[model samples]
Target: MGMVLVSHSQARVRTHDKCAPLLPLPMMLQRNVLSDSAPILLSILLLFQNLTISSNQSDGSDGEVLLKFKASLDNPAALDTWAGPTAPCSGWKGVLCGQGRVWGLQLEGMGLHGAIDVETLAQLPGLRSLSFKNNDFEGALPNLTRHRSLKTVYLSNNKFSGEISDWAFSGMNSLKKLHLENNKFSGTIPATLTTAPRLIELALQDNVFEGEIPNFEQEGLKNFNVSNNRLVGQIPRSLSRLDASSFSGNDDLCGEPLEACPANYDGPTKYDYHDDRIRHHKFPETTIAVVAILLGAALIALLGVCIFLICRKKKSHQETAPAATAAAAAAPATEDLNQMERGGESAAPGGSEGGKPSVRLLTFLKEDSEKFDMQELLRASAEVLGGGVFGSTYKAGLNGKKMVVKRFKHMNQVSKEEFNEHMRRLGRMSHRNVQPIVAFYYKKEEKLLVTAFAENVSLAARLHGNQMSDHQSLDWTTRLKIVKGVAKGLLYLHNELPSLTPAHGHLKASNVLLDAAFTPLLTDYGLIPIINKEQAEESMVAYKSPEYKETGKLTKKTDVWCFGYLILEILTRKDSGVEQQADVDLATWVETAVANESSGYVAGAAVFDQEMAGGRHSQVEMMKLLRIGLSCCEADVEKRPEMKDVAEKVEEIKEREFDDDFYSSYASESDMLSSRGLSEDFRSINI
Candidate 1:
């Protein structure tokens, strides 16, 4: 007799006559139909014929399993794709087929109902995974021990009830992930789960399981949860390594990660009190009466003293009323004289001065300018720089040093603590491109932030301000440098300050100032958390991103959108006109220009600043930047590139420009040397 081995691909079979004695008798009999004994040979032939027939009908068996499973569904409408032929491998929804047989079925959230036909499904010899999660399936989970091929099973978010006995997962050595959460299963979680040596993830949350949690700590296990159960006793020491969230809602569960169990306490117990051991005592009535009379006399004397003090305070106020009025009237004149000597205008009436409690200036930075206090800040020569949605900014000069003070208008909602916290966080940030806050003053009625004055000008002024004869128009190199600096600054804010939501929520050209060397300095960073939403919207309306109206929340993506507009403003040297009656947004205008140029109807140079275009600049490079800007302003927030990515791309562009210039210079030098050599050769030939 010969032996036959079936290959994994069931389509192939091989026979080895020499190995006949090595195989079992039944296997040998089945493979060798021409055995020495006629009876044995005949029996083996009959069995082989039956196996051939079964192999040919296995697809039909799989189709039957699918049809039965579909029938068990309460809502046929949910399985619309399960209609037509029962050829699951070809057209069935959620059916995965391999090696000419069904291997996986996922019917998640398909409105399935009734118990799954585990016995019928087990008939599919190749089925390896099953998912019925997020459905209406109910009833006790059937025995899955027969389905040894299953590797993953998800039965979560259902109404499967009853105790999952120790034998439920018996012999399932190949199972890897099992999700049984959000069910009605009760009783202790079976310690038998440790039998599955390959099991990795087990989720049993939101069940009615009680009793002490079983210790099934296996080296291969990675994720496990039994939260929202009635389990008692200390958590297994091995399982304490998992997150506390995994064991939460289990009231009686205690130990290591959780509260330690009481040393002398067993589980819950009842106590009985004996009434026979009780005793009572009484005090003398005359002693209590004497104490009450003494207390009444003390209260009468205290009341008389309080009344006399009230009359004396009223008389004192009456005498001071006229004097206070005269002082209040004369205070304005003194304030004017002080303002004149300080080389600045008078502080606004009803400001942080005028009979208010003096506040101390809080400085987060350790700069020399921190020496000035609240009196110096109030007395500093002040002139209104401008007023925006948040409030007005003032250019204040104290002694010889100059600074800018931003006084918030409608920030009454922000408490003093929150304001100080925001200022401290901002001051801690140290970046070349970010403007540092020197000091801040917070009061109930007023809040002011002081920062060093940017000596050059703002990006807005450089681009759109009235160009004086002495002022040089920002060249292409300077503009590119400014954009790169702003992007790098934003990237720092985004990465270094994760706690600050919507990092640089109000980024705009006006907020970007230029230093003496024309380096871009970003101001007003991280102000969104403390400012009023309505005021933020009203002031930053011009730079409001596309998602602002829809989400009504500021996000880092919105800041990216504002950065995109800032790029457009710098390149086109035009404002978005959101603050005016102009209907065209800067981004929209640039997009239209790019579209026309891409269509070959207009030169790409049309979208660039005329001063830059008139100079030697790459129109191709300008178009590339325009494309980037458009991507940042995309209506979809998710599509916008992160600030880090933006910074990298801008850096690449900057490097490319340097390469172009280097190559241009090299070519010019080569031409000059060649001409000189030719002239020398001509002179030698003439001689």
Candidate 2:
């Protein structure tokens, strides 16, 4: 949506007039404000210094992750340049982070190579942006659907092959920019994928797609590309307006701006050419045969004409056919819709194909169409409630049978195959505090995920004042237990188990599904990364790392920062505990917090009251955790920690809390169920 008009800067007629193109753009914008070159160099140096500092300090407990990432970079010089001391995170090249995590990992055109594993990157929860353009990467793309906060994914100019399958991008609904141009992929483009609501740019040119182009009409696509493929036949006119370049280079492709095949070349050129040869090679014999047949046909026709005339005359003499004969001879009972159009009645619109319409009947019919029944879902939900991202406190039910229904929003951006893959993956996930997905449905493009909905609100809900006043809120001991339980879940995702693929990419309070026993169940664990294509850029501003605003790359440390933020949100029932802008770095808050700790510095009392008050954890401990978050949000990748260390420290913190009496008070009575509601279930899936 933002527009930047760039031209040469040298032809400066005057300050009010347009400048010539030869002058530098940076100089043109700053010339009037500054008279010397020293300031510009200083500013540039500061920026670089900030990057170095961010890279060095990011991901407090995940520095191992950074080291591994740095080792994979093509240009090791970048590591030396940006990983030095005294450098500021803002000055780092291709590094961005917020609240202490590595959020953006844009190393475009750095000549990065070597085999890459997506699992290494998945460790960073706070990552929301990634870019690896113009590289020598090979093999299939890494699965990034777990990073819930991700918004931009740029992986163009690589050596990726195979068909673009739905499983590759299972939950990337919040993704706004997906650039996969200039690859070596083949096979038909999945029809269900083109309808992402948040998508703005789609560049799939120079691939080998061979089927009908999927529908891209409804998406907010400002740019599209499908050229240089094996695609044949007429291009969809709906996409014709984009640009000729988008559909150019396919020899078999025709129609729209491209020229159509010549009208003369009809009925397969080979057939006509062969027939013409037959006409020419046997001309004499064919001519004689035609003459003889014409003579014979003339004699026969004369005789037939005489007979027909006699019959016609006799028929004319006879009376008109009887009504009974006419009735008996009426056309067969097969439907003649064209005749019906002229006289027969038209049934009412929206009626069932079998009979009259009713809400109950329609619901029943829709259920029958699926592999399950409707009434069974209503009865189970009356007994339990659950919660996740879209909101808090959703009730479950089943009409009569022992079914479970968990209501959710139709995040219509998810494609059918992607949703199914995500559900299957989620279903297989084994964790004490994570709910497994069963099945989901999408009707009219609305996405609803059916999971084993837990029976209670998250601990954050209680902290945020969601429970009844007399309901006896969680005591400090119970809160500590809850933290430990959640920490265990995080540890499992971060380490503990060697994952075959990435785990939860997004960690947020709203995603913390809770059972009646107060056990934290992380719902939508892997959905965040996949649903990145769901909303606009603005909608993701809150959850996205500061680095994402500049270069889009999600690092393991980014997840660390998000986990830290989740920790804050849990402790303080709020999402905006810290906010960082693209232009103004997150380090500002870090520096302020650090400065206030000095003896002579004047501390902001409000910040102190909110961040360090009451019988909560000691300021040193809180600051340690905050620093961990800040380190993870550091603008540099090399500075972040590995999840193993973070999980260790989190475990330590939780173990210390379990000794309190509050840990003994948690309720424990909920049984996990598989399927939820039917209509609500069917209407929400996007396949």
Candidate 3:
């Protein structure tokens, strides 16, 4: 719709039709002001501007703009609080207000998705910060370059894919702290991102970026990461001082903080080199003696080079000769690998060759898993599931069954034979509580793991994403079952894969899936062997264990400590995404909350999810479970109970209504105090 204009002196200003693009008010007024009969109209327009400015706030224009923006999301209910007559600055959720206007929208993990309406956001002239971190928003980012006034932008942990246009960040002058980590955004990182004069803290990890990095000149840049991507070439010198973890997960990247680049390497260069400059230089062969001397020196140098090459080749051959036999069963013939890369549709999923191994690169680990060839998987219609610290995950359909394909960028910790052997070992695991590996694909740049999709989604989604939807929140019984099952799964992993450190290395709510019956099954297990050491240390939940964090030590109890964090999340229904600056996790929060317990279980009750807190016995059971969790999470590592003990404690605590006689699982109050550091706070409360 076009803007309306009225002139007391014979109104004749033409208005564009609805289909036409709207022009800025100044441009619209300029067209009318320059007209032959417009001196009177121009003077009246000035009076109109004055009147418009006065009614702006009362007109509810900014709130209306946000409403339209909310409507554009696939799940608008995520922002239900953004509705109504209440001023956006006063009551709307996530709308940051200052100086009586909307300046920021900090929506994180509200389960919102779909492309945002950039035009609607543009209406708020005072807008500065925009955060959509940990949401499900997909598609290429909006035309956000126009939002030059923006300071910080967080699109991390979303499904936004494809290469951003080079001009996308060209006009973002005020930009800083751009976090596009944990997404499927591909192609070379936009060089125009350097245009932002205030740029800092650029996080581009867990993506599909390729080619050389841009020469970032911003002096203020402190936090940066391009790890877990398809990036190649030397990192920019400006970012070399950062920890090696920042550049992990990229196999081809080289230079300081990593390995040294080749001496003749021309950075970001596409052409082949052919150097012959030495031939053009004139030799100072003024005398026959000088010529003879030069000839003798050249001959001696050539002889030395030949001797070194012969020795190196002999040494390399001796070393590799033994590896050849050991690696024989690990990979297929070179021809077979080339054929697979060429998308040879000659073979079906399990059609003899998908199983063809370093011993089969495209091995179907499970005998019963549905088969598809390399070509089929490559061509399958896929949906982005989510991006994690490891890499991007997708839901792909094959043979009428849904399968999850998780891409990992840094599964290069071991040789190909060792990797295949480890995958086989993990595949043989047949536990009820563990998610089975359906199939796997191996390539130099990345690796893919496939498994059956769980219908109930992840435990994290049940506890968080669907809380506002029609889906009911998981009650105490279900939460208890999940933790029990997770504990059982850990027990199996430890018993079956005794060699693997912590057995289940990446335990978290998101990694735990729920079946139709609400049974918890663990996935992404035993991956510490393949993950890059630096990356695993930096991002994996197991690495966040108390002993590892404090002393750079990893014990058998490291996974138990991670399990404790999971218990805290399930009980409290609260989890802090790493994106948050506070860095306080659920375990720490529970520790602090329970530490301040006064009178009785009053403080401890506050830590549990309000929905699940009720019934005298249930409260007691929660306290008991809280104790178990804290004990498993104990910082001493020595005090933490074994997985068998933890599982037994969980099993001992059952629903109070069914059992005629209920008793505390521990031997005595003093026993609980000694077992867990968090138990002392609850001693005053008689449960």
Candidate 4:
């Protein structure tokens, strides 16, 4: 089953460490007076002395239990990180722990299959949460009632077939959320849901459950979705308050949120409003009587509305001018790149491909750039580099210069004057770490921004590209240089866009364009004010901040979180896609890989990218940066360091010089490389 989210509430296990410490001073003073009590004191000391040792051994057992579970999987590579000696409570993926004991396992989207050994799981004493979402689990589930402490169970988006027995959840008294969506469960929603008093969220959508929904009476069941099932009959009164969509896709299910359920049926077989005589009309006689009067009154009202509309026509047009310019300016403002896909340019001056209107020469921000008008742009040969939620980007060869044209929609939240003012502010930005806005064209509906074409690929390509190419994997020093540049660029944006929600609303590895020298240039900065706020939240990286999800607000620390994600991606040579088979949220994955609370140290060949390994000194510096990255990715915005402080932290990680022979032994010969936005590729042969 595919799960969207998972959480675990944990109560710390009171480890037996609180046994009376060896307070020898107190005993020494009382030794002479309490000499007669020596036998009792010796027994007490021995009992406590053995208790701590047993607690340590128990903690280690949790790892053994998880390793056995991993061994049972059909594809063990999914749990490769679980193979190491790292304690399950310390750093193993999907293993959640608190107070040095495992309490939960979040194994969603791990591409897992095979029998889930319920007996093995019962070995865990306090395990409270289990999310097996988006896996390949098939056939009947094991007797989960054996482990009754389970609280949140997510088994959504799986191939598990057959009806769930009513006794499946029989003793899960602590259960709070149960999701079985996108499966083949039949018969009916488990009747045992009513037994769990604390149940709050239940999702049974997209399943084969039938025979009417169970009457769920839990007052705390605030979230329930049973849509797209074989449910029939009236929705239970207890669930009538749920949204209409929750009952959609069930053709037979009807009531309050849907149409009234046939009004007890057989009330009337047929009716006809087209009948000429009132007797032929199946509707009431009074309804026919009022029809003539209503039509007369409606005619008189229509005459009044026409006169009123005529009087207000002049003022209405005046008011609408600011909301929109000439409609002929075109609504398809994001097709400049699509023109290239058609195999040739539109001969029309303003790119007739999308009906874009011809304006004068565009506003140029740089003093030395050769100014070109709409006519020249329409004639240039262009190729689309990329397209996303904002719009399409085109790499155009215009007047012998390589230029990148970026088209954007949904920038009309502000008036034309204010939009131009924001563009001007962006143009004034002049840092090497920041992508310069060379020119811009603004309309009431959309915008076109231009900049110098980047000769190298984006950081995302360098990091994730699967093609065989020289310098596919980066070295330590090069990665350090890219992230340091990123930090500095972020600091500059924070200073410049002090009023913005997030200084760079779309900061991501793909958004960071690297120059030939592998220098990071932050793109798409400070547009939160102009972009449609709803779309930005859905599509931009800034809203990925944990606080935004919890509070529906954005802050400068959102940029910090994005930067932290980039740092972790660089260190792990991984992407940040949440559902990618080979990757997870880089920050969360890193935290799990090295959460060594017992030792306060995470150093092994597994923690860093094996290809990026330099001398041991390099690992020390990488550790410092990793710590800083984790700090930036903190869930609490207040805990995240200020962007200024983060910049200083990055700058302080000095990559010191080592002896020539020692450096050559561990470091790559190609120390410098062309920038790929996600990773910089330095080819030794080219150097």
Candidate 5:
């Protein structure tokens, strides 16, 4: 039920391909035999069965392996897209198909907290590569011998445990590269792994493997690392070509890479042996037991007392360490403190035993809760709001006050000091659309951040087809207001604030919440550092500026690009259809589409044709925005526009209006927009 990717080769099928004839007739027949809901259920089950059967019937498919993958996680209903037209493999979420078969399965950071179904994945005889990086998958990796065609396997940064078995990878003879880094794997490296004749790279670093390092004699093994483990014994001369840093962390290791093994110490047999016999007689067993019991009891009591005293001292220090200052000046410092503390918690370095790092919990008191819990707020409107990239949200009433209660999925990666400092900063901020932290509850593993609930839904929700209402259609005026509101929020993040802190690296339509007046309020305004990587990935995947991948740093320029994308979302009335592009090669499509749009060939094309199509957004305006977006999505971080310039250009376009004349003659008719780059939008007369 988790993330199970299966490959089945058919007569070739494209992204826009239609479904085969056999699958739908059963649904047609079921209409008479089952009730309304029953038919839906039956259809879902039938579709899964057909997919299983079809996959099994294939010469290259391994059904049992696929079944094991399906059993390793929660429901994988998100992957079921087989029915009316497109088969699931062609357009399913987290699937990549090429030449009528599943080529890769990249479910990286999908909040998929379950064990991997290695068996299921191995069934796809044609799978060239697979990656489940930065997820919450646990347990030992499954055997994958049948998938001899796999070129790469990236299972890094997971919770996978157990010793690396010889059979675990002995079957994958064709694997060119393997990444098992940053896991809890132990035991000695299997000598059989060295037998992979075609393996080019093997990364088994950042684990708990011990014992001697094996000499992987394969000449083709160009990149191999067994670093940061308890490995001992001498390194063979065959691996002398590798950098010494690769074998640095281990202590007991010796030889040329390290030093010569310690000389075998021979006892001074004649004198020492005679002196040992003259030593005092051994103590009685009863005396030893009595003394040991007394010492153990004393140590336990002393440890308890020390812990109690430490807690008391810590609590006392917190109370007297300076009272809360006014929100403006002190808020930035508080936010900074939170950031530093959170960063420390996240980067938990070594010193752990048993392969498990230690974790600390957080808690907040009710009596110490903030004053904004006004009841009338929720009384007027109370609804069960859903969860976001960070956590769940709910509409509430606080003494006639309406507010939003955001229940964050807390992790051991944040400390109490960080949470307190960040909350203080959030409390000081007072913006209309920007949700303020009204109250918070942090206890043990549970943490709840309460904010004033807004009247309107997220821009993404509004843009979604099923959720859009006639009256809610954002006309030109409302769209302008939305743009301005978002711009101002971003402006505050980039420049208006005393501290030049960038909004947690992402700003998509979903993060932009609307008030009753349709004013945009940026949520998660000051809570980025408190988020875990998995949670951050959920929020960032769509809105992430391209520079993030290269530098791994969040900057104001990144926010500007995100803001530009949000503007494009508003103008086009599209909810970043990033998730929908799971079937196609998104990187290729975006690049090609952006290029075509830039050159004016696809500039004012209808919404249906281009990915960013919709009558709500002006083609000329959308094209202009796309130009900005392409620049923002540029690989070079320094080349992107700043927020101030972005806001000004957007304001200018709104005033000038994007009409026919605006679309036709702005640039050359080349296949790609001239990489002419970005400039200041300082035209005195708007556009």
Candidate 6:
């Protein structure tokens, strides 16, 4: 039997054997050739149609995710390239496409505002890098656990706050760099962050995190920080290898790099020791009785001596009263006669003729000047520079020499001996960065410090004050050098005087005077020890750390915090303003700018000094400096890097700038050579 076949669109057509028997087999075979391949052809067409549908579905899903993300923005004008019905894979801004799907979304520094649409953006199956740095994005962090393929999540410099969920980073095993610095994030750092086995860098500085730092001993973890936070307790032993700056700002923290924990200290405890049995056992009966008898005998002897001294002082006062009155009446006339003859120099006033208080010039260095008295200081030509937290400062000229004199306004609690000790300590410090106290005057009514006058302006004046027409504005290179110099000076103070005044308790831009060569000279060092706590607080209000507010004590970390703020001030040229205006601080302003910039807009540029715009500085390099600045200003003091680390980082930035310049020049020279047909010679020189 023979069969006949025919073709219909996508359907098979065959003739039965009964019908086929009527036709010749060779004729049917020749007629059925077209029909023979119908099934295979139809199969190919159907397969192609299914593939088209699948592709359309994927494209539609990606488009929907992107649209939803755009809809979430508070300002969409910055993302004009993302408009229209064009597919994201075709050429959307910040959207990278690969393998027929969205591969990356790098919209950093965009003026995008509002909360991020993390769920919608996570729908893109191939998305690897999502950067929202320097944006105005607010609200709690979105759930990113489902985005398993994300490698880099840069959400720094934002207003994102609230405690991050413990499971926030659970599924992000592929993440390498997670930068959340300069944000308002609060609460303890998630332990889940340590679970991310592949994380290379983690920056959580400038947040409000509390509690002990979690152990991040992972082999791959290289860079980490939690500085300027309210974190307490010892730094994790695993992290002890990091620089002291990394844990600088947390006042309550203690460990090897910082002040060691006291021997009896067992962390924060609620209960006091009031047990009778334990007290009695510690102090045996015989020892306690012997100590009590000795104390009583000492008290009796002290009382007897007080009576004898009081009687003798009364009799002496009665006898000396007449002579003191006669001396007081004649002192002014005698001083006027002496001043007229000695050309304004006279004996110090307010003392008796025979018992005049002698003026002593205590100095750490050898004194070459003739014996000078307090009368010389009073007679010197003096101009009031300004009043500061410590006291009023004066520029004085005496014997053709200029010096800065600071008269203490609120150091009454410090005695003569204590003031002398402080002056000697400061005089002994001869570091190039620290301003040495050349001489000091101690009296019942006044305490004064004398230091060499810096010929150039202070850092504060250079940054915030009006510029002179003849003087050039500080370029990026100069600014960087100043910052590095300041860091070095602070490091020297912290390292050399860790036991005395480990931190510059009153570090401010105004106190950082620049010498003729632009070298930073730290002033107001070692003042915290001599000033009362109340005075210290009032004087250092602008530079005080958050922990200082609560504990009323300053640490090395506090100085780190102040330095961080100073860096921001230098970069932005904005006054920290009054403490009443919390949002006006350079830190908050910088953080906001950083957040706005992360979304692919240039919002962060708003905080930079306008003059910096004309310089040859790279925006990328500026951003790196901003990050470093923000890290120093971290709310977690323990997470702040030491001044040494900061100096090194700044040095690294300078080196990076040099490298960039070198490469750029090299490339330009190469291009010029290529145009001139001398590229072969240039290439040969490389060999």
Q: What's the CA error at residue 388 for candidate 2, in Å?
A: 9.7
lDDT of 4 by residue, 1-687 (tens): 111111111111222245545654434434543666676776665566456544564477788888898888788789887865667765688888877788899999988998787788889997998889999998885678988899899889888889888768865768889888898887767766765667899998998777766667566788899888767777878788889999888766778687788867432222211122533437777887899899999999999999999999868867797545444344333343356535467344364433444443477888777888765775688787778888878877897898888888878687775576567667767788999999988766668889887766688878876573654677788899999999898888776555466878888888888778888888889888789887877788877677888999988778887888789888888777631323456766665555432232223225677777666567556766776776777777766666876787677676764432222222221211111111111011111
Global local distance difference test of model 5: 0.58
Q: Model 2: runs farther than 4 Å from truth?
A: 1-372, 378-393, 399-410, 470-477, 487-506, 528-536, 540-543, 572-575, 578-627, 635-638, 657-687
In candidate 5, what are the lDDT values of residues 1-687, reduced to their tens digit? 112112112213532266655545555646644655566678776787577655554433433334346556775543444222444354556666664467778877765666666656766756788888888788887566667678888888899888877546654557788998899998878655654657789888898877777656556677878788777677866676777777877765667666766678331223232233333467689989999999999999999999999889877656653432222222322232232223222222122231121222112323345453222222233456665555556665555666665656644477775466556545555556566566665544546666666767677776564555643566655766777777777766544232323653557777788878899888767556566766665555423545665666666576766665565566556555443434433233444555555444443333222333333225445445545554554556666666776665565444334343323444333422332254332122111
RMSD versus native structure for model 1: 24.2
CA lDDT, candidate 3, residue 80: 77
Instruction: Estimate every model's Cα lDDT from 0 to 1.
Output: 0.69, 0.51, 0.73, 0.71, 0.58, 0.67
Backbone clash count, each prediction separately: 1, 107, 9, 16, 26, 47
Relative to the true structure, candidate 6 reaches a TM of 0.45
Candidate 6 error regions (>4 Å): 1-356, 359-372, 467-472, 541-543, 578-581, 598-603, 613-618, 655-687
Q: Tens-digit lDDT track for model 2 on 302-416?
A: 9999999988877654546653344433322111212222333222212222222121111211122233422222112343344444422333333332323343343556665
Residue-by-residue lDDT tens digits, candidate 1, 169-286: 8657688999999999987787557546577899999998887776564556789999998777888786878889999997777896789999985654311111212223344799
- Count of clashes in candidate 3: 9
Rank order (by TM-score, best first)? 1, 4, 3, 6, 5, 2
Q: Which ten residues in a row have the lowest lDDT in candidate 4?
A: 678-687
Q: Each prediction's TM-score against the native? A: 0.49, 0.39, 0.46, 0.46, 0.41, 0.45
The whole-model C-alpha lDDT of candidate 2 against the native structure comes to 0.51
**Worst 10 contiguous positions by lDDT, candidate 5:** 1-10
Model 6 worst lDDT run, 10 consecutive residues = 662-671
Ranking by lDDT: 3, 4, 1, 6, 5, 2
Q: Best TM-score goes to which candidate?
A: 1
Cα error, residue 627 of model 5, in Å, equals 2.7
Q: Candidate 3 at residue 290, lDDT?
A: 84
Off by over 4 Å in 3: 1-361, 467-470, 576-583, 598-603, 656-675, 678-687
Of candidates 5 and 1, the better by lDDT? 1
